[model samples]
Target: MRLFGYARVSTSQQSLDIQIRALREAGVKTNRIFTDKASGSSVDREGLELLRMKVEEGDVILVKKLDRLGRDTADMIQLIKEFDAQGIAVRFIDDGISTDGEMGKMVVTILSAVAEAERRRIFERTNEGRYEAKLNGVKFGRKRSIDRHNVLSLHQAGIGATEIARKLKIARSTVYKILEEMKVT
Candidate 1:
């Protein structure tokens, strides 16, 4: 049976060194390891897709941790079930869980659920903090690239949207959007 390894990080700035080292120490060859610098919530990861295509029946997939495999509980459960049906086993080294037996499957499910719950909690807390900040008059989102007042003055001075956009180095759509907002206000 072929052995494959997968590693992931939520952001591009995060390092995969530890996971790679762990996978290598587990006897997974360097060439057989797939890594993605992406969020676990995203299923469109190129590395993960390639790994899925490469694995065959009787092949085993190894991950450093269960949460590293996926953050969504349903997705994680579905993946494990799919692998199990295809005669493939998934081993999570840090969690010490394997999808090789009923007990291991059960534990993985529970842990996945807990991880998903924690993710939801973090989401809720972040939204709460954002709401509180908004209430306190803190602004969010990207700063305005062009000055609204300048756009209005330029429009009042008979400057066309295209001319304003060209002068400001912004899109014509942005010039029109600013003029529209000024009309409403």
Candidate 2:
């Protein structure tokens, strides 16, 4: 079977040294190494695309981790299912997972579930923080561009949005929004 190695980093600024070295030491051909430096939220990554184009049924695609393939469990599972459907196997070097095998498939599913649960926890914590902030009377958003008197005078003058923006030294959108806010208040 053709062994294809996929190396990825979450951001363009990071290096792929570790993943590449691991794949090479594992006996993956240098020519088969595909690299991508993009967020895991993206499914159509450059390296992934290259690997998909090169690999055929019975070929193995190797990754550093399941997260390197996707941001959450759903995406990871979808990708695995797609590869399985094509009769292509995905192997996670770090996790020792292989879609070609039974145990590896189960491990990937478990890891993906954990990742999804962790993502949910993070979101829940963020929401809780926001709720506490609201309870403490802490205003969110742009925080009232200027005071009441300044905004009221501008609105009363019936000045055009552009003129108000120029006078306030803010963007036209901000000026219009302020005027809208004034009307509501």
Candidate 3:
């Protein structure tokens, strides 16, 4: 039987030693270990893809945590379902549950629900912030600093756009844009 281990860290600086050791201690072969440093926020991971390609029926896929699989529940569930479709079992080291067992499926389901809840909460909070900003008369975009007075004054003084931009320490295109905004030729 072939067992493949998958390990992920949010950044390359973080160590994958813990997961590697845990998987090896769990009886996975050293040559079968696949480790990477990538964000768990999404499923578009290179390491995950490599594991998917190599995994076959009855293969065991190991990880450290549920979140190491994904940041959202749907993504986590999708990952599990992919393993399910391939008949590959997911063994979480920390949780000590293997998808090949009934208890493991229950744990994965619970964790997936929690992840979905967190994502929904974040979405609501973001919407509330935007709404509050609008109600408080606070602009929710980049502030406009076209310098209307300077542009109009310089243009009225018969200054060329290029020279005006140099004087203002801005770009020539910025001068032209200002002129356009001011309805000046």
Top-scoring candidate (TM-score): 3
Off by over 4 Å in 2: 10-14, 65-67, 70-77, 139-185
Error of 1 at 163 (Å): 41
Q: With candidate 1 superimposed using the best TM-score fit, by how many Å does residue 83's alpha carbon deviate from the native?
A: 1.2
Q: Model 1 off-target regions past 4 Å?
A: 108-185
Q: lDDT (0-100) at residue 80 of candidate 3?
A: 90
**lDDT digits (tens) for residues 8-103 of candidate 2:** 898878999999999898789999999988888778788888887888899888888767777756667778777877889888888767777787
* CA lDDT of every candidate: 0.88, 0.80, 0.82
Instruction: Evaluate residue 88 in candidate 1 and report its C-alpha lDDT on the 0 to 100 scale.
Output: 87
**Candidate 2 clashing pairs?**
none
Candidate 1 lDDT tens digits, 1-185: 98899999999999999999999999999999999998888677899889989999989999999888887776777688778878889999998888877786686678668767877998999999999999999999898777899989888888888998999999999988888888832
Query: How do the predictions measure up, each by TM-score?
Result: 0.59, 0.61, 0.67
RMSD (Cα, Å) of model 2 = 5.6
Weakest lDDT window of 10 consecutive positions for candidate 1: 107-116
Candidate order by decreasing TM-score: 3, 2, 1
Q: Candidate 1 vs candidate 2: which has greater TM-score?
A: 2
